[model samples]
Target: ELSGQWLAHVIQTMRLTYESLTALEIPNDMLQTIQDLILDLRVRCVMVTLQHTAEEIKRLAEKEDWIVDNEGLTSLPCQFEQCIVRSLQSLKGVLECKPGEASVFQQPKTQEEVCQLSIHIMQIFVHCLEQLSAKPDADVDTAHLSMDVSSPDLFGSIHEDISLTSEQRLLIVLSNCCYLERHTFLNIAEHFEKHNFQGIEKITQVSMASLKELDQRLFENYIELKADPIVGSLEPGIYAGYFDWKDCLPPTGVRNYLKEALVNIIAVHAEVFTISKELVPRVLSKVVEAVSEELSRLMQCVSSFSKNGALQARLEICALRDTVAVHLTSESKSSFKQALEALPQLSSGADKKLLEELLNKFKSSMHLQLTCFQAAAPPMMKT
Candidate 1:
């Protein structure tokens, strides 16, 4: 407590020094410059120091009238709500300030940086939730508490400069709200439900925007990546030389690269996919469709390197399977050979057994392709 007081005094002293520049009869331009620097220092200090989950930050936020919007937040249990809400209200002030065009500090944070900060804030909420959930006798069903946000005394000096727009900060707020913990998330979703609003919908909309940007990047770099790579057969037949088949699949791991971008964008934004009144299926389908479409486009540029088509692929499959059988046959797990031989493949294509000398080349795992004659699979359970 004494240390907290000392910290408060330190902040107050800095404020006094900030205000004292005017008494020095400094030029108005010079005063604004110093004030901007002071505000930056103050904001950085508050954000860093107030990160503790102790009562100090909550007390400070409460005492300074720093909270204002607290309708559904009451769902938070008292033990958990204090620090989370306090942290949220403390951070919210940064989003509230709106300055006229053409002011100062360093350049403002870009949209990506803002989203990253938003994600960090939500991570704190998740931590709080998990902390309470882990307690042996914790009761969460009846837990209800309230939170609010407004500017506080310590943070009063911090305001947006010319660089940040209110609209941009609002986006950050929405992004942060999209990832509330389960109970609070349900409360907020219920609010959204009443208003016909969907957080998942908004998140998907934002995701599509990002996807468009990535698509544009891919389109611009199409010629450079040579979307069309020449493919061929190792068997002595084709004359497509100078073209490497290894480059055929988007430089390796491109599918994962693109999927990872979308996954990262949504990871911090949606806590669970199953907790939706009407948004889960829509969101999942959209995600799968988007990836499938992009990957299909990439796949179009790929063709079989096998010069011999299905005949070649099936022969290779048979050879690979037979090899696994021979290596494991000598081991104590001898029944593995019978199981391996039963695997269905193009039965008419090639001999099931491989030559004894060929066993050395079969050190790798066998690959199997399963087919369903049905166009669509039936549900595992009755609807």
Candidate 2:
């Protein structure tokens, strides 16, 4: 720490001397030496700082407990949050001028330097996270394993390492990223602006863009991880026993497959809401849409369906829609509507009446489950 501070002081002093010599109209040849020295010292300072920051982040990534909760629901910030906090603090310490130093002692180019240094440190932080959470060569294995969604232990089978599952690690990284972007980065920008730093906007934009891109990638991966198994189960659950659609009777209640799928979907909602409720709607919307689209496709592929069979399928879809109505995007809602339309319509007055009664019962049952799911959600504002 002392050496770093000493290096910063030397760079600051050299910069001041360079400016003073230039103001006096010193010969170019004479000023060039001081300018070169300043450049060299600045490079050394940045390197030392970056190397130190990277090492700290790597150590933290290795040593810190990444899991917030064993059951995967908690209001606490992610374990790696300190990695980012420390990096920002380190940057501030290096760039901040001494309190007693004159404003002129601060170089005009300090704002640009801050922006560059900030980007470098953030990049390092992200790289460390990438390394820590990286999965081994299990892509092919997971792809094959995920196919058997009928298995109750599908996720367990795919991730049996006894550590954080890939999806859970992703959530941790994503939660940290969101916190950094929304809170920490904003605070840093504000601090810089308060110091009359120019070009802070550029820093905020570049950093935010990077984090947002990572957020998007993480969100998509999570959707894939959680949604695929649920969608895969839909087929066997809906078309159980190779039962011909023509022989399908009027629905007694939601099918076991639909019930099981909803339970799983609600469990996913609970998990995400536990870790990051702010992301719950966005995450679940995509998951629901994927499931809805698959159900629609399954309905379209049906070789035969009695009116009662169609009614059963429609009831299942409606139950799904009602359960997650708040999270449904316009696309998901349209998919559900289209899936309903794809079902055979009932013509008899008695059939229509029966459908309505069954629909009402299904809605009531689903609404109760929805209530329970919502009740389980953590408060919106973190304490």
lDDT of 2 by residue, 2-88 (tens): 455577788777777777777899898887787656655654565566566556655655553443432232222333345545544
TM-score computed on alpha carbons, candidate 2:
0.71
Every candidate's lDDT: 0.32, 0.66
Residue 360 of model 1 has an lDDT of 26
Which candidate tops TM-score? Answer: 2
Clashing residue pairs in all predictions, respectively, total 7, 0
Q: What clash pairs does model 1 have? A: 66-150, 67-148, 67-149, 67-150, 68-148, 68-149, 74-145
- The per-residue C-alpha lDDT of model 2 at residue 315 equals 74
Over 54-73, each residue of candidate 1 has an lDDT whose tens digit, in order, gives: 43323322222111123222
For residue 302, model 1's alpha carbon misses the true position, in angstroms, by 46
